[model samples]
Target: MKMAGIETLSWEPLFVMRLDVAYDRAHPVGGENRRGIFPVVGGTFEGPKMRGRVLDGGADWVSWRGDGTMLIDVRTALETDDGALISMQYTGLSTPTSPEAAARFARREPSPYEDLYLHTTPRFETAHAKYEWLNRVIAVSNGMRTDDGPMYHVFAIT
Candidate 1:
């Protein structure tokens, strides 16, 4: 299932695991913009299949499908002092021209896979939140973002 402008690829096995995130109010201080890395551990035991686990807190769990999509839902539970459950989903695309590109992610350490034309729908719980305009990029993933205005290259790298 490809989303028009974004490129999709077949099943490429990547590491999958359920992690217990310690709660700290200032933990995600920088939010998404803050770049950080973590070591993921899980091999043949949970390899190339649907893997899932329930987190300690309620309404929290994570599952990782072999495909390339990572399903993450971390809402509401964060208000507590404990922590939130994490789930991952991977959806493998069959149309990628390069098979090796998919294989590269199946390893102990995987290189970054770029994703272009990624559309994100904001989830605002309260009515007080104000919506803003979408940021326009010249290009991503070696292709253009908006076809109307100017040409911007965006590639579905990840």
Candidate 2:
């Protein structure tokens, strides 16, 4: 079963790969935790074929093409299965400045519909964008300002 838009990027008989990939780079970011991990996932979806990639579990980057609409955003986030926090931020398109604005693009429901964005307590010490509650799973699609900009939703899962 798929949770959030983050379905099993790679489905294996007994082990389905979720968006919880980590990198070798690990450090501290301005007194915050730096796990060098990005919880991003990609899969075929309904219309635009949404593809997501995390920058650090905090930012999500997505790309998809529809009838006459092309999407690209890199401002998305996700939590880890082990309760680690990661965040993503884009250098190009201006990301949401406020939590309200950021949330405007945030997923309202889970991916594939029924699956809800799971939440858990972060084990690492880090400062995320704004949202108080982190999501275990997330989906990217068309929306107001969110779906309008380039797919720069960067993500960083555990």
Candidate 3:
């Protein structure tokens, strides 16, 4: 069997979820790993197929790695305006370009998205009959950090 070339793949805009989350705190874990929790307060999402609001109570389970790069792990619940529920999860990395940049990022200070390569691959699940397509496809996400929280634009791989 022959593998398909990369040029055959394409991305379709899934939805943009501007998640509003706040850092709970950070602490040393297992003597070497740094862990933190960021609560998902609230926000909204929109795209060509579905639109919804992100609910609160969901949390981002964060791990600080040795190379000064942050590993993002988040679980989110979305309530579509039409009353459907969608589960969202994403994992990615935020690696700063320099030590100063890393410091600024750690302190929750203003930093550029270009300076810190922040990206995530998002996966989605939903039971709604109309939006069931989400559960079948894979999604790729990319976004930046806002003063309020982290924002993401997810695209489905087609």
Best by lDDT: 3
Candidate 1, residue 107: Cα displacement in angstroms equals 2.6
Evaluate model 3: give its lDDT.
0.81
Candidate 1 yields a Cα-based lDDT of: 0.25
lDDT, candidate 3, residue 19?
79
* Candidate 2: regions farther than 4 A off: 1-69, 89-158
List, residue by residue over 10-113, the lDDT tens digit for candidate 2.
31111111332222232222222211222333311111212223233332332322221212233334343434344432322223344554454344212321
* lDDT to native, each model: 0.25, 0.28, 0.81
Worst 10 residues of 3 by lDDT: 23-32
Cα-based TM-score, every candidate: 0.22, 0.19, 0.86
Rank by TM-score, descending?
A: 3, 1, 2
**Model 1, which residues run further than 4 Å from truth?**
1-97, 113-122, 126-158
Q: Give the TM-score (vs. native) of candidate 1.
A: 0.22
Model 3 C-alpha lDDT per residue in residues 1-158, reported as the tens digit of each score: 55767466699997888878765543335336578777888899999988989998788878878887888898989999999998888899888888887777768776666658888888889878998988888888877777767778888999
Sequence-dependent TM-score of model 2: 0.19
Query: Of 1 and 3, which scores higher on lDDT?
Result: 3
Clashes of 2: 41
Candidate 1 lDDT, 65-104, residue by residue in tens: 3454322223221111122222222211211124454454
